[model samples]
Target chain A: MSVKLTDDVGAALVAAIVARSPYRRALTPMIGEITRIALANNQIRAALADVAIRSNFEATRTLGRRDLGPQRATLMSFLEYVYFASPAFLASVGEGPKEGSHNGH
Target chain B: MAIEADHCDVAIVGTGAGGGIIAHRLAKAGLKVVSLEQGGRLPDDYFSETAPPGAKLDFGIGPSTVWPADPHDSLFVHPLFADGAHGATPRPADGFRHFQILKLNGLQNLWNGVSVRFCEADFAGWPFGYDHLADDYSQVERLITVCGTKEGIAELPDGEFIPPKPLRPADTMIVNAVKSLREPFSHAIPNRKAIITTPGLANSCISTGICTSGCPVGAVYKFSARLLPEIAGLDNYELRTNAKVTRVLREPGAETVSGVEYIDTKTGERRRLEARFVVLAAGAIETPRILFNSADDADPAGLANRTDRVGQGLQDNPKSVLSTSLLKLWGHKRTYDIGYGDLLILMSRGKLPDGSDFPFIGHAIHGLPDVPHYLSGFAGFPPAVKIRMARMMFHSYVTLGLFCAGEARPENRIRPGSTTDSDGVPQVTIDFTTPPAAREQMASMLKWGRKILRKASATKIYESIDNNGTGIHYAGTTAISDDPSAGVVDRDLRCHGLDNLYVCDGGVIPNLPDKHLTLSIMALSNRLGRHLEERVQSETKVAA
Candidate 1:
């Protein structure tokens, strides 16, 4: 089954993945750019084929979270790459916590 | 068309750690130095974080297009390993793919900033000992601003260091575990790195954790960022990028080199640059390749192959990685304070087959940018679960990267390939097999690594052992020795029979140490620079 990486699909996929993250609010603005680039990758495009089988948005979201073997790992790697590359995500984590917070005691 | 270039006091082939430092040192001393770099200069904003996405993105955390993807590229040097019976095969390991970085600053641009000095025992077969290069080491440390603490360990000698970034919770846990070990295993210190830690520095490390991809900030030590600017203003120094050196040209019937022949990569024109002294700092692989390709009627074997040792005794430290999840720090907030990679250095000693004490070192790495990438590799986890795990368990993760010493075997060598490259230089064929002792030592190191992780109460542990040459710390092709019969270069790094040709790269390292080789290479280059400065002065005085 071939699924075209359209804007709607890319946005839905990126949104579902970002929703799983604790920093979703911070990472929300980056989804559009991340989706544009992530969809260009053949691995991500191929992984979206599994998502196209489901009819509803909730089904697509659940399928993205479910096990798809190596594809799942591929999706996760792309997600992490997006997070690291995101300016918002970097700004949030770049300074780290204040000096007195949790020094492994 | 063949073009005659200007003559200089020294013609250094390569602008990496060795060539960059030597050029700086000589040019600073008022000697005319010309450095030939095969790769062109990268843009000033090449490593900038806000740089536009395609090539910059590939350079940072993606499959590096920064390194030549094809062997046919001018910057690429083909490396082949020996098959069973005289045949060769492309090396299967991906780690070796990063070996050749033919850029203006060479491999230093992609280095991880792990700066470690060779200890007293690491100088076993060399003509000089560690003490001989101690001041040189200190000079390099100060120039690069290495960060760490003085642990006073004999095997892992302390160096001049600035304050290192404070250890994260995961690092502290691992350090305590290593400290709890038995004799010969209790030594652990902050990992010394060539990085700018001084606050308010122009581009200080902000703990981006994406160092190896190339530091966006100029915090990590890179010759392009650190040394190039220093030498650029010198009247005596000239840097010619897109200059691919072919071979050192020795005058007929003379033992000294006359000049060098190279291809101007931009114009595709062959040119000759005459110099009083020729230095090959190309790299361990490319340096030997150039020497072997210089074979002619006078030397027959090669210019420096009077002892047939130009491409012999190649060695690279074998490495093993142990990934652990500290149970106590699970679900803790992930901190972005990775100031370059490894946070702590764990040193220990093990017994060889002959019962001799062997030194081994392990680096504790946490909060690297690729933590999530590693987490994604865990089996049975969905994409969402893995992402959540990465966010939650990032603070708990620690990878112990251990390295064991490699032996300098004559059979393990790099020779010119049957075919020539695009620039007409012979392609490099690296024929090396990991010694059984190295494998055994790696196994032992992994065992010790596991023990430390278990002691730290790691909830899960994973082990991965890389093949030889994966360490990328290649050395010992043009080995140094006092006796002319055994080695290619002598005590002063001058080619055995060739008076004016010298090698100042990792090629002169007689054996591979457990520590990284960049610092030692830089120190040797520093020593060679001082030596040449004195030699030139003395020669000028005698002539006068």
Candidate 2:
């Protein structure tokens, strides 16, 4: 089964992931791939997401204040990073550049 | 993939001092001119006379600021300056938005409003000297609304100007020291600088001490808003923003550039433009990058890189700061102590063992602006302590000794690298270093500054000093020569191997002598504009 992803779904999934685990460098690629596969596979998408959310929620309860500040900035940074890094944004913008940006250096 | 060429009599790149001066001159001469600027045009309201709270990102903090370049490529960015080698891909700056070739985040970087002219001996190695460029310099000075005075020094050129802004008490003390040291055996003059009170921003009119953050009032000349207005009404001129030239297209069987290909920065569209003559005022780094990227498949070494000098011999004016001791002033507190003063000018006085006298550039002892006051106030200093600090500052002086915004040997140089962006345009490798002589001069100047201040009877003096900020002047690499085997462009500024192409920016100064680079750059652009006019007129006659 294939599951279709929407903007809200992507945002919620990212938020849920952050709400669960603090920034583990290892988690980025894992979440990215899992999200991609979930979007591709319809049948297990919602179920897997629900399970991931439950586990992530449990994980968040164990995180302390010491990890919050950087985690938030990093998450904000990651969201911004993801937005620009999205294939959709890149596709619409294409690879061609605008003027006043060339430096050759 | 759509490529269309728009033709013109002359096409100039960039729109700062170099491009703006050239446009004004060429358009005045009745030639149709096209100026391609990568940055978007700012409306009349773009500049705020009020103080800006933070860094303004035209592109992005760095390479990230520019759209369409590889998001990964942050080596080259606008408002260029010296940081590390532009060739070195830097790790992301913490919390900073992006990376760039040069780091110019500071308000006191680059020329920093120093507009002194090149000295004669300083021009010995240059193709022409003050006499050659005098008339043109005057013309450009008028166009830019320069403020300066004639010092009658051989190494320094004088120009038309407003009345000299008098030095503050602190600056006066140091100036007295340098002058007092003069005698038949000594005869040394304090170095000179051009400092003006910007009238644009506020009623600080008594002495609009703001110079670095850009004159809130248009007292000092900034190219975009100040000088361009003089040439705004010319119908023959067209300024195109966001048109980034990717490559220069040459004639099928000739070295002549027929036109250029560019990317539309906003729409991300590819396009082309044609011109009979092209003046590249895209500044030191970008100018050469354009040449490097213009290398056609048939000519891989690059269009103007035959000598490989297209990206060699890069140099920034080497500089060091000298500070004086602080003196206690016994007087009522006044706002004058915390004001910026005029940049004084003088010549080099030392004779080399070989009988050659190196030009000694002079900077006025600038008074401390109100920054410390605000900082101290913020830190909760008592009013009495703040007044005492201001009083001591009133007697302090800092004469920036001239060690040659001096030229450096090209061996201490940077290069253009091969990492092309998504557009296939290569990147620049900007590397530079300070010479031993420059360093020694810095030490000596600091010692001298202290003595000078001591002469004013200072009770205390800070031992530590500033380095006049990182040497921001960038040049060389694509120097002008008649032969393709020597420099990138010919003496006419035409690319040696490619006709109809020219670079008229600071990058052509093979070795920048100790002088403010902007004034010379403006003069050179004026010269290029005149040369272009002559070329176009001759071509029209030939056609007739």
* Chain A: TM-score in each model: 0.60, 0.32
Question: Model 1's DockQ?
Answer: 0.09
Could you give candidate 2's per-residue lDDT for residues B195-252 as a string of tens digits? 3334344322223333443333344455554545665566676777777777778854
lDDT of 1 by residue, B1-544 (tens): 1132479889999998899889888888989898998888777766554332112342133322111121112112211112212122133353243266667777777677889989898999888898999999999999888999988777778899999888777777787887777565457788889888776777677665445556666788877788878878777788888888888897665888888898887789989999999999998888887887788888777778877888798888877788777888776665445555577888887666677767788788775333133433454675467556655665577778788887888888887666555555566677777788888788778888898899888877778776555577888888999888888889999988788999999889988888899999999999999999999999999999
Identify the runs in model 1 with alpha carbons over 4 angstroms from their true place. Answer: A1-105, B1-5, B50-98, B334-336, B351-357, B368-371, B382-388
Q: lDDT values of the candidates?
A: 0.72, 0.53
Residue B78, candidate 1: C-alpha displacement in angstroms: 17
Binned by DockQ into CAPRI classes (incorrect, acceptable, medium, high), candidate 2 is incorrect
Count backbone overlaps in model 2. Answer: 36
Candidate 1, pairs of clashing residues: none
